[model samples]
Target: MRFSTLKSVYQCKCPRCHQGDMFLRGKLLNPAQFSVMNKNCSNCGQSFEPEPGYYFGAMFISYGINTALFIAAWVALSVIYPDYSLKLLLALLGLTVLIFLPFIYRVSRSIWISIFVRYKDEDLPSSA
Candidate 1:
């Protein structure tokens, strides 16, 4: 599949058709509704949930994303401030994770879906 498909994932659009929105409009910072996804793609009629427990695998993706983010932060901080204390590094990592939790959750779901679904040329409008 084309790497361009990742644009859809990053935008939280439908995996099959990049035009549709994957998530509903709401306060994203609100954890209670941070993951409110559309039942189906408004543009392509693709179901968001392929099956029961379909999103269970997304947890693993989320974990991987968090791990990567933590590692990157640690590496960057260590390089930039060689004498920074471990306590400060851990505090910054905690804050970063907390602030980005909603984003990571949504992106992980988008990535998990994109992994199983491929964009079809026919699904795109003729304008492309």
Candidate 2:
């Protein structure tokens, strides 16, 4: 079955075919392995990194995601503890960043690639 672009992105699937994984399986929480990605799409053979520095723009995406996370954390802390100290806020922000680094990194790359790679609805080759 065909998957929607948003679904494919959320699943971290190849942007073109939406079948192959963009990143290594079961590695999201593994700090060392979290950033590892498949060299190419197993189904469409699209290069995950089209060229050197291709992911430079993805860094900006990551920054935006982190900013949102920080804002959310600050708002939550404000509501949960009205008198929370600056130290507490800093600690919470640090913890939030550590907890969400992997997710943000992966999603940023997925979004970056999706911007350039359009989905294709066509029969896969005999060999994937």
Candidate 3:
């Protein structure tokens, strides 16, 4: 099922249903359903992707983005939330990474085709 909003490009689906919003409100808090994808298309009821291996690249994408976010976060925390013990800082950072990993995985996989996906029918839904 597609859970993506518009432009499947950034979606879990084609953008025509009850879903698309994973979070209750602000993005700072983790999304509610980080590991869940819609069971069926919200609109046409068609499968979101044609097959497996379809999302293989998603892992790589997620890794890259996650790494970047982690680095940025550690740097920011090191600068802003300074004064904590080294062990405590490291532990907090580790916890933070774990907390964000699943969410980032979802977003990265959801937007995996952002760079290469296309559609013959402009009217057709896309994951752009």
> CA shift at 62, candidate 3, in angstroms?
0.9
Most accurate candidate by TM-score:
2
Candidate 3 local distance difference test against the native? 0.56
Judge candidate 3 at residue 58 and give its lDDT: 84
What's the ranking of the predictions by lDDT, best on top? 2, 1, 3
Error of 2 at 99 (Å): 0.4
Clashes of 1: 0
Misplaced by over 4 Å in model 3 are 1-33, 81-86, 119-128
> Which stretches of candidate 1 lie above 4 Å from their native place?
124-128
In the range 1-128, model 1's lDDT, one tens digit per residue, is: 67668788888889987778888866578878888988999989999998999999999999999999999999999999989998999998999899999889899999999989888767546756
lDDT of 2 at 99: 94
Candidate 2 per-residue lDDT over residues 34-127, each given as its tens digit: 9999999998799999999899999999999899999999999999999999999999999999999998999999999999998887855653
What does candidate 3's lDDT look like per residue over 87-109, in tens digits?
Answer: 87678668877887766665675
The global Cα lDDT (0 to 1) of model 2 is 0.91
- Candidate 1, lDDT over the whole model: 0.88
On the 0 to 100 scale, the lDDT of residue 75 in model 1 is 94
